[model samples]
Target: MTITDAPPGTRPARRRTIGTVLLWLLLLPGLCWTVIRLGGWEGHSPLVPLLAFTPYVAVGAWVPALIGLLTRRRLPGVVALLTAVALAACVLPRALPDLDKGLSRGVALHVMTSNMLFGGADAATIVTLVRENDVAVLAVQEFSPGAERSLAEAGLGDLLPYSQLSPEWGATGSGLYSRYPLTGTGTRINQGGFHQAYGVIQPDGAAPVLVESAHPLAPAGLDLLAGWAGDMAAEPRADPAGTARILLGDFNSTLDLAPLRTLIASGYRDAADTVGRGLVGTWGPYDGDPIPPVTIDHVLADTRIGVQDVTVHNVPRSDHRAVIAGLILPMAS
Candidate 1:
């Protein structure tokens, strides 16, 4: 054989070695993601934004496992298989409905939340969603003065009469409108200057419920990551021994993030997750960008609240899809 020519069996052996290397390269990222996710390292700068796409990564993880197995690399195949399983374990549960057998019977309340995209979403569509869904409460993010006027002109006042609004010029504003009278209305501004409007409402036969429109800053870049984490940390927790609470809007956080998970662990259930609709994407592509959809907007209710159903809907000119949650609130004690 010439210098450049391979010996009889060397070609096959070299090919195997290169294939093994490629297989390991393919397997390593998913393995690292699993480790970081399990270890709660997603709070770090790059990992913060990276973890938001964990669902997609989990779905793609099987490719490496399949490749390794078909290539007859037993160790790499087994490792890749285990890595896929671990990632899947972290993600698949969001698609399965939770067994909420302990939920108490009470008043039925329909709540809808949407991001107005800097007052750009079609107000008529939002009002129609509120009217047709029989929405008892509506929480809006990126609420602006123009949006409020548009919604008012769209006849939102006739249906939901009560309002607590923090209208601004940009994405910093938020508001809460309810069919029932709202008391203790106020706004909490996070470190990122996003407005979170809140109020207490008492439905006909149920206990008082504190509802808040949450709009944490998006972790789009390294500069905003700290603020995003801070805002998420500042979210009001559900008090089991106190008022039943609901927090909903553009959280700018996915269920895979540590901060959002911690918030949910603090006496709240993600409404969509409870009803097996959590995997549905609530943001992306609506603004005409070529981005994959992700579940960032959420309706988080106290554990005592029973989530009967949850759905996502489209709104023209908005980047986010509206999330509507049907909740059963416990009766007054």
Candidate 2:
């Protein structure tokens, strides 16, 4: 039943034409996209392809996968399979953003992001990890009133000493705690009913760093993702110091998403990538299955901030693990 063993009849001209069209249609966009991605030279584009066209990127995986499916041609199928594998390696990592093992050692600065589940099941355990690490800064999401009190009692206030706490309408609230002196805090950054806090963190004798602790309204619909991108766009412009920003939170969007692209184009570098760390899945003990753990927590910073190490701390109390990162600020020459 192989093509070579077919009966002594020529294939139809129409069949040949359709195959040609399908081949061209499948190959062209993927090839062009690969080229475009390579050409970017790790530079910024006004609109990042991932965030702007998430659907295109997601479904685009089929180009190579389909090539693998349809082709009987040995060379073509192998090429398609290899291409698909490589792209998947590059792109699929984003699906587990927490898997990124971030910086270590060369850290002049560090931040830890965790979702406390707002005083859910294990508030005490979460607080202990925070205290034990001596986390210089902590960004917590889903803080409940009782959890807040427990965190305070766990010596978070004495350790960080300077902090901002806000209880918004949703179950998720954002807070920032710093060992350094806090210069100021800004108005809320709201998008589609989601509220985030923006503020400044300045250590003694060091230049101030703008920190935005946000849990952007996750996209429940097609328009919501784009709207999230638009909201992030305002951060840099609204807080000019956002270029010197450190964003830590559970974005709920994967690194492969367009929102991340938009953030990177605005001059942020993923700390995990910079540090060359392994995948650190922050969320999901999912029914105790470890094969594919989920990671929603992230630590992103400006390129000027060098990452030395990033680690995922497991807190048995909450559903999400904590993303802890160490950063090195540019040395003054």
lDDT (C-alpha, whole model) for all candidates: 0.92, 0.61
Best by lDDT: 1
lDDT of 1 by residue, 186-259 (tens): 99999999999999999998989999999999998999999998899999987888888999999999888999
lDDT of 2 by residue, 1-333 (tens): 655465646445445655756665665565555545534331234334343232344356566556646755444456555555555565555434443333322337778887766545365665566677667788877766776777777667777888777754345576777887766775465665444555787655445677767676655465565665566554452233443678888776545454455676676667665555424566657225553454456787875566666878777667678788877654332
Clashes of each: 0, 14
User: What stretches of model 2 exceed 4 Å from their correct place?
Assistant: 1-72, 75-79, 92-107, 118-121, 221-227, 235-243, 284-292, 331-333
Model 1 ranges off by over 4 Å: 1-4, 101-104
Estimate the lDDT of model 1: 0.92
What value does the lDDT take at residue 267 in candidate 1?
93
TM-score of 2: 0.69
